[model samples]
Target: MVFAPGEKPGSESEEAKLQIASKQIVQNAILRAVQQVSRESRQREAGAGDTPRGSFRPGAGELTKKHEKK
Candidate 1:
């Protein structure tokens, strides 16, 4: 089935809102992927294997540090 020819699609304001929302969704996805790659690289450099697939702790990476104490 398709929309009838006489039926109105939507208002111009609604169309503009939809466009803005779609762009925001795409941008959010790209940013998240970049952040994930950055985190994984840091883990590798720190000698930690791939991060486990689970909830990410806020500051678990700090524990892996080797502080020199006198």
Candidate 2:
């Protein structure tokens, strides 16, 4: 997506292309930000001195206890 002050205005097709390009750029930036945040969270967890108390894992399937009746 090229934006120039002196250049001729874009045609309809050119404008659509520019819009798509801009959307993709925004989506990519958001994706990168999310990834960075996730990475930082993992780093913080690793550096913390205290051990996690629970056996539960985020996004992992639920574990059924043997004593529980189905």
lDDT at 50, model 1: 50
How many backbone clashes can be found in candidate 2? 0
- Model 2: residues with Cα > 4 Å off, grouped in runs: 1-12, 50-70
For residue 22, what is the lDDT in candidate 2?
Answer: 99
lDDT of 1 by residue, 1-70 (tens): 4444565565345567899999999999999999999998887877544556575869755644365354
After aligning candidate 1 to the native by TM-score, how far in Å is the CA of 69 from where it should be? 52
Model 1 TM-score, all chains together? 0.48
Compare the candidates by lDDT and give the number of the best one. 2
With a 3 Å backbone cut-off (N, CA, C), the pairs that clash in candidate 2 are none
Cand. 2 Cα-lDDT: 0.78
Q: TM-score for all predictions?
A: 0.48, 0.52
